[model samples]
Target chain A: MMRLITSGAGALLGGLMMLAGVTGPAAAQGTGSATLDAVKTRGQVLCGMSGSVPGFSLPDSQGVMRGLDADTCRAVTAAALGDAAKVKFVATTTQNRFTALQSGEVDMLSRSTTWTLGREGNLGLMFAWVNYYDGTGFLVKKSSGVKAAKEMDGATICVQPGTSTELAINDYYRLNKMKFTPILIQDQAEIQGAFLSGRCDAYSTDASALATFRFSQGPKADELLLLPDIISKEPLGAVVRKGDDKWFDVVRWTFAAMITAEEKGITQANVESFLTSTDPDIRRLLGIEGDMGKALGLDNKWAFNVIKAVGNLGEMWDRNITPMGVPRGINNLWTKGGLQYAPPLR
Target chain B: MADTHADPRMSSARSSPKRSMSFAWSDPAFRAIVWQVLIVGVVVGVIWYLISNTANNLAARRIATGFGFMDRIAGIPIGESMIPYNPAEHTYGRALLIGVLNTLKVAVIGVVLATLLGTVIGIGRLSKNWLVAKITAFYVETIRDIPLLLQLLFWYTLLQGLPSPKQALRIGDAVFLTNRGLKLPLLVWEWQHTMVLATLAVGLVGVFLWSKHAKQRQDATGVRPATWPIGCGLLIALPAIVGIVLGAPLEIELPVLRGFNFQGGLTISPEYFALLLGLVVYTAGYIAEIVRSGIEAVARGQWEAAGALGLRSGMVLRLIVLPQALRVIIPPMTSQYLNLTKNSSLAVAIGFQDIVSIANTTLNQTGQAIEGIAVIMAVYLTISLSISLFMNWYNAHIALVER
Candidate 1:
């Protein structure tokens, strides 16, 4: 009887594997190729993201998914599917993010994932564009009598494991020859608890995350200070499975469109106005007088739809992250002395 | 009448073979074989399909699949490890081995301590004192009810909440607890320590043989002899004598508060402590219940008969009840040990740098997910099998002997 049951289960799993074999390769091409065609036929973009990062992915006061990462997903869907709401956000964790992407559980990952050459080659994925540039920093209580990360010799630092932040912490300590103990935690909640309970002398993570965490601390916001140390450059970006050049192009250009829209003063509210404007660059970008979207196998009005639906990159950041007190420093457009620059639509 | 009965029986016997042959499909062996073949075929087919699909998918996406990536430099630093590991210098394989060693260190220590602590609590749960029983019960209930992850988090939080190293809670001139970790005296080894250690190992072997000989003599002569004193003499006194002959084996390396934190001492990081404590406390609860049931399963008549035979309560417990109870306890106890080992995987969640966490970082850095997972599963499976084999041997030795 046991053997029979085992065999039966084996058969079912086998059948599933067979089905996966038929669909897997095509799915791996992602939503911009065969997978995208499939998605269009099915009518929804599978978006993977973290559901808990407050200013990046969490729901808003109205119980709607409202965050920077969430908006990025919306922007992609709006561009490709002609509707900002045509997306399914699958909440993922650090442990399952790659597998979720590899297995075609989601078409794209908008999670706060750091892009590295190793992940690009190894995880069978390609990063589309860097959405956020982050760096490791430390948060210490004002009473700790330590003003800088260098002063934290032999201090207990609380850090989340299984992320780039862990490596950054080690590098910072080793480079400075600073002896410190690490209290490694697995989740954000534990890191928060450990730091808040005074278990760790300092908490280390991306500066943006630290800022968001500080703002979320409510009344205790003023009691802690983030040290002016940027240990590692963390370029977080959207990613698709590797080998789908067409899909990669679409996702990359979609981001560029948002940035270009912002640079051209094309707000969501004023996107329609630019559609009729005599500006040739604006006309080309809005697909009012060019075949750019068609070249990527998308509708000509793809960028126009994205701008009208999700607004520009600046608007997305301000809506989702600005309230969290993260300044638009390096994230601002190149015209505003930031690093954001988009290629010409023409 | 005799002729008619014989003729009918002969006819039925002639047809019996034919009938049995027709019913071969219902035979258990035949059914089992058929089921096995069917299942195996389906499973293999499915696996082939999935493999091909994944291959196609990777090929289509241009994602390379192989373990070649493990050779690449990890380029990530591990926080704590038993062996020195430089990510820039070490391959992923080396980093993973370090992780495995760290995991084993925690598992070995945790298993020993948790068993000792759990056995005490298990016994306490059956104590005569209501307060003792209730408190043990409460401890088991509370710890078991909460998720190990949450408990780990709590312990980590509690450890971090300790005062800074400069203002660490110091005990006399030795032990200290700070936000960094708990620091205790380190043992300063001397050349004579090798002699002492050799003597201890020899003494231990001598004590085991002596106890066996003593037990055999008692069985033969029907004269009970005290084994504890003799065993202690061989195990402890012999070691001590050897140490004296060698002029003291070692000296304590007292931890002193240096410029910032204690400089020369063995420190237990808060992460390791949290993971260990959480695993032990959670596993102990299930172990307590197992002990309770095993003790209860020993027939009351056995205890009564032992008492009637002039055996004292302690003697009856040791000579009769315990031996019987062990038969029921060993199997479940082995499972609990396995559970504890697996639960140590949660160490990654709290930053204990166990095999899983290290493997994850290795996978991330090297992009060798398949190889990384294989390493983790193999290490854990080996640990599990070895523990079960050891327990099975122990169980077999104590098995019942029937006339």
Candidate 2:
């Protein structure tokens, strides 16, 4: 009883002295390793996607998910469940995406999300692979006569907050010793609305997103100009809750298979025909001659299913992004002078 | 025979030994104690279970549970703040502090403006002019019916639809109204200005003491003296004279149209303006109803008596109705003020970085959900308690004492 009383009094004094200080170090934790078995048992994988960004993760008029980011989700589903259709897409906002993943609301997030060290360190989430190489850029009306970002000093830039886009602009302005007004908004639609109405001088976001926005929402494609300058490096990718090494490996290898398929000249149409090829790499990747799937505790046909569902990386890009005026540029395979490199299938 | 007379009750008690074993079930006090213990035990057990579960989840996720992250540098830029803050230099703790100050800035100014506006509308509702009362009623009905969030969105959208800075609507050269915000001339601060402000505070205290002394004299002599003009002279005129003597330290900084926007004056971002306007306008609707009821609650006989003593209608209101009405108005008005303070958290919806909004960003950036939520709660709790304590004191001071 005396010990309890003393401890209670000590807590009161400690609370008073450091009302702002919380005791103990932060635990950078993630979901349990049971996610792999859980997803298999549930019979469907829950995939998180940004519901509004065009060419990335928007639903069609028929309510079917279709985008470059959406293809990643399908690939994951195909690898895990052996059926691309065995997936549910949950729309997520920038503010609540991490929370959704952490709370087990979604199995994986493939929302054209940027991979950042801060998120990796503290968010208890791991990036599976960089599916898109993006960078922060500015979008302004061509008629505004703002040719470059440096010329945009003293301009009001509208950005959706709670994203890396906000911090990138701040750093750019501060480093240039320039002053720019930031109009922070929560919704991407609202930011576009504000920018379209001339409330903001320019809209700042990822270069690919800017292209999608301009093509989908602008009055005319020629009226808006995406500036030549790329201010911040933004490698957009897929993310999963941390601590599930098997689940992470499943997603990671599925991504690698898509890239490897692209490298090996395999498309969704030709994947079945390639099964008879004598190439050892093709045989190993197609699971005709290796225990790669068994090592990850999956069936031998996992990589083959992923390739058939989403095609190769190049095919996915051509289907979703190429038509939207976003070139593969740096996102092409390393053999094609780009950054998308996959390890040997063996 | 005497022993037999005493033995009947004892004999019955002895005969019912089985009943004695279950005495707690029959005894009301004992049964009440048992019920209380059971309820308390269940509540404690549930709470313990929840805490342990949360701790387990945090440990499993590797998300640390602590306030240590407050010291980390906050890299996100705040558009504006009442305190000095640099995104690259200040810690998350400082950023949150600035957020708290911003919330207070809106709430304090909002409460004052809402009260003044509400008092006028309440009196206007009681006006003899038919148009005045009808318009006031329409305002109260329309504003109170719509949700505050919708009102905030409407105001923000409307502000965003205004002309660009280069083509801003201006009143003279000192003020500009544009989509960016309201640009007003700022008072350029110098070191001497603080001294002048301090003198003004002292003068205000002096006036208060003087008024108290006058009240005492009036009670002793049965003769009241005019204190309002003297009080104003000491509080305002004296400060002005001293300020001028100190070389007129307050200087005006006028806003000028710069390349893409205005520069040199105070810029009230549209987000802050919209949030302040929404909170004040919505709260004033409820406050007006409270004020009207409080005024009506005053006894009609008191007004009649004041008029019977040859007082004018205005004087009767001031001397008989208002003092009494204030007693009823204050308690409910305190609640309206509290509601306004709490409602200011909606600043997040409009992109105004209030404490709740900034802490949310901090938590998302750091992924310290427990710490972030605890900080936000502590801030609101402190604000709520302070307001309540002050209001309770004011209520007690004004309460009637029939000794």
Candidate 3:
């Protein structure tokens, strides 16, 4: 009986698949050509992003998207099409981000997604660059007197389901030989609400996100404390479908140019003036000396366009994340004892 | 008409020429066969194209396709599980099974409670007392209108707003209601509890056999045997006597306040509490309506006849109204059962680790969208099919017979 029913269902799905194939021939066109060619033909860069994090990809009061993830999308568009504003941001959750990219639903993903071995090795995605250096942290009420995560033994923690941070919390608690209960909530708003209402002893997520939520929605930022102990390393970066090295390099270098511009003291306001600089490295990056832009099949002013549109990495950070009270600690340039070092422009 | 009737031979000769050289298109069987062939051909063609397209796309994108990831360690923690699960030790497959068990737990409990509550409310809707009838009507009207997901969210939020654990509402130090959960004292069992459990199972089987024998004797001798007392003695009293004789080994583990929360009791987390309350409350409304209509489907003459024959109201309902009304209720009730099972998937929204939610997490972590969704689909299909088969069998047994 089960076999009969399953076969009937299979046949029905086949009929539907046939109908879909006949009616929508254009759906297969993405596979017929390269993603770069498709994006150029479409005249817009389709950028996948996490759309609700406060300082990551949330929309502003004017309905325009702002944040680090959103700026990354604009940077890609600026480099590829020489028009930073000509990009469409498709909001994705942790669940569907990779599928969306692999299925040609989006050109590239700029969500603050963590780069991991499974994702890069077996999941067929390549991390372009580590745009943000983040780690998991715990959020507890100030009155709880939980100075660090080790003190959070026997505490009930609320963490978002299906994220790396959820695992990190379990690992932290288990390794410490402490028994703790977990409340796994999905929506960000619900988790924050639960934490605020004292349904859980603490909320756990990326440290920057914890800061974003604490400052944005709370009993007041001072009433809540973000524990100083960073447990697991979460290198959040942009991801793209593998097997497209050309598109990968374009994205990777766009990130590199931003960091290098910040290290060279080239602010967005001062980017255009560097075209006449005597430094060969600056000239090569600005597309005034070398064939770097030609090598990537982009225009000579691709890096310049990215800088002009989203500004240097420092300016991007100072504008979007600084207001949320997230200090640029490990996210600082390599010369300042930080992990964010861009490759040499040459 | 007179001319055509008079010239029958001429009409027959004229139709003979048309019939002798008829086209195959005029044959209905031929037309049906041709259309069927065309549709099947088109379907096969499309399936082939889609399969190749997907294969090419997956290859081009380098997305791995297999079920090997199921064995990988699922590092994510589950809030509540019926089976033993450790995030460090368990595989993703085990986590998903735990999720399936949790889903079943909610679905089975929800179905039983909803049926009982619905039947009571449904009978109340037909009550002679104006207040009882009107209140039931109001309940059905109010509950059926609000969306279930919103109701679930409301319940979760309401539960979360209760006092913290330290200031929890306590009853006799055994039950505590806090924002964290409802803590209730649970049985802490020793070795003798197993003997009690085994004795109870044996007693239940004995009760079933006794009832069957009683029915058979009544049929043969035309004298109905009283089986209720015998059933109570076997199923309940027998087990209780034996358990007590063996020294009644169950001990209560009452909840006590620890530093931040209650410990040493059976805790029903807010997510499970909210999900159960929402599912039961929402589904009871529909069930109530079903029950009301099912009872009404019985003819008024049956009730009147049963009452006139000296049967009491309870006996009349049990012997006449229910037997017939059930035939109408069973089919729709089966659908409601399926709906409740499917709706339990919404547990993910409230942070309940149902099969769908866990599969989604696995999908997200492993980046295996197709395989994860396939597992969900297969599990739901099995559940839905099993429920349908059981209900269908029951419906067949209770189906009306014509002599």
Candidate 4:
């Protein structure tokens, strides 16, 4: 107990020192490895986000990032710096996201980036944890008379470049002996605009993103049809520059804590009441026992801070994604027969 | 010339006096050489520092380096390609080559079209009629002032307002212009057409030989034989007769609407068309200014002199003033051409996959940012230098001889 108090006091002093360094250079630093030192010194987590993506990282009416992905960035900041709001969101594109993370432009890319083998094996970046399980889908206009993705032969597709959408469509069509012309654009608004204006026959992206874009259409959503073809499996997650094993483990355990919190029935409001619960799993997860946080070079209360700051993963999804009318199907806890299975916290 | 600052009375003392090999700072030549070497050394040192710093940072980050990824399969699908490409089968190198080709297609066609439009507008700006001059002047002023990117977006938006393929604007059965693109019938080529092409090539060679003969005749006897009538008969009439003899029919494949789009015809997508239109229109505004200044630099007396030689106003402007003006026009025109080519990189914003756009995708996919940037730089450098060399040669060709 004395050790916890001293460490907590030390962290507070560190935070104050960081605040004192506020007069330091405000330049966006994207340096080499040891990104943790930079984030701690700057007292802010530079997180990459696709701010145009709804239910993921879209900006709210107040211009604050409000989405599942944005909340994940907050959770990461809480674990790393003990402050949920101490993250600076840098808007990234499909093309520049990986480079931004690799170049240290952003310490964490929680931008709906898929965990691909190529990215892991080639790019010096690690997919710390899968936040959302998704699949590639096609959205076409209802008047196009196209029923299945199979019937999209000889079609022009408006797909964002530097995404799995392009590759999946190409391989899927080629395997089916179909053909397509891709209209590549970087801006999400423009790409969606192209689809609505009938510039391309179909728009191809993630199913979740397609739903978000359709929901954004308000009344005109009826004109667009979200086809039932999921061409590829996309496990979306945050990425950090590789070779930083400590940072990688910290990011991994941060998501593990949130998902574990959801499984253990710990919402932010109910979490305080359950600090006295006798469950050994609960005590260890909340940092009551065990040396789990010691291995991470963090305080035992890191997981507790994360939940208290941003709630569990389920609460985050409810706040960010439920308004978009997308039900929690595969993103539910493993106990509910979803893919979001967290390894035992102990 | 080097001693221009020396006083005449003090010239004997300063007569660039004895070529001394002293390395002292007092020696002006030695000081000049030292300063130049120091500046160059600093420049080279800074560049080396940048390169080494980048290498160290990239190594520390463990980002992949080198160009070996070029052989990897590039699953990027481009909307348009000059060469046949299969995303699954082709390598990244092939995809980059297609990007280079797409860039060249826009640049070459843009250069030709911009020059024609700019020359016309430039001449119109100098017209005696106030309306023509003001309208031309207005176009140049407004277009040059507005950003090219905004104009591209406006053009893309305007194109999106066009009807869908179902209710497309059609010119009979052979052509359709929809929001998709301009669809036009493609002529089906056969052996007969190839024969005609071969005949046309022979005719072109013959026409060049005839023009050379005409030039020699004019030089010797001052009586040049007419070359155009011969050029017409040999070039046009000969190809027609050959084609007709070989029973070449004008067979064309009209575009038929299939599941999602036209299948048989050539589609000039709105992305490419808008990019082409935007680039030509914007670059022409600058080109028009260059052309106008070039024409104006030709003295009014030169035009009167040609008129005094019994030439009509049109003939005098075309035969004398325009040729002289071209000598002034070619140098600046080359820079504008380079600008247009570089500006083509903006195609990324509008969904046209040029070298920069495709290379960007490749780098992201491969994690070779430095190599990808290097490829783009090398391609642009090669293209720009080629243009510069060609323009330099043309400039020398049209230069006036002092004699």
lDDT of 3 by residue, A165-244 (tens): 87778888779877678887676677788899998999889998889988886458899999999999999999988877
**Cα lDDT computed for each candidate against the true fold:** 0.79, 0.83, 0.84, 0.85
Q: Return the lDDT, model 4, position B105.
A: 95
Off by over 4 Å in 2: A1-33, B1-38
Q: lDDT per residue, candidate 4, B121-209, as tens digits?
A: 99889889999999999999999999998888888888988988888899999999999899999989899999999999999999999
Sort by DockQ, top down from the best: 3, 4, 1, 2
In TM-score terms, candidate 2 sits at: 0.89
The fnat scores of all predictions, in order, read 0.52, 0.43, 0.67, 0.70
Where's the lowest-lDDT run of ten residues in candidate 3 chain B? Answer: B14-23
Query: In candidate 2, how many Å is residue B263 off?
Result: 1.5
Off by over 4 Å in 4: A1-33, B1-41
Give the lDDT of residue A213 in candidate 2.
Answer: 89
Q: What lDDT does candidate 4 reach at residue B187? A: 87
* Tens-place lDDT digits, model 1, residues B1-403: 7577566566655543343333378787678888999999999997887677666766665656677766776656666777777754787778778888988888888888888888889989989999999999999889888978678767876777788777889988789888768889887878778888888898889888887888798999987678889878888898888888879735778777764457778888788888888888888888888888889899999999999999999999999999999999989999999999988987766678888887766655555555567688899999999999999999999988878
lDDT of 2 by residue, B102-138 (tens): 9999999999999999999998998999999999999
RMSD after CA superposition, every candidate: 5.6, 7.9, 6.2, 7.7
DockQ for all candidate structures vs. native: 0.36, 0.28, 0.42, 0.38
lDDT by residue (tens digit), candidate 2, A1-346:
1221222233233222223222222332322336767777788999988878888888899988889889999999998889999989987767667766776668899987899998887777899999899999999988788898999888988887678988899899889988777776666776788898787899999999999989995558789999999999999989987777878998899988999999989999999999999999889889898898877767788999998999999999999999898878999989889999988778
Candidate 2 residue A46 Cα shift, in angstroms, is 1.0
Off by over 4 Å in 3: A1-33, B1-38, B219-222
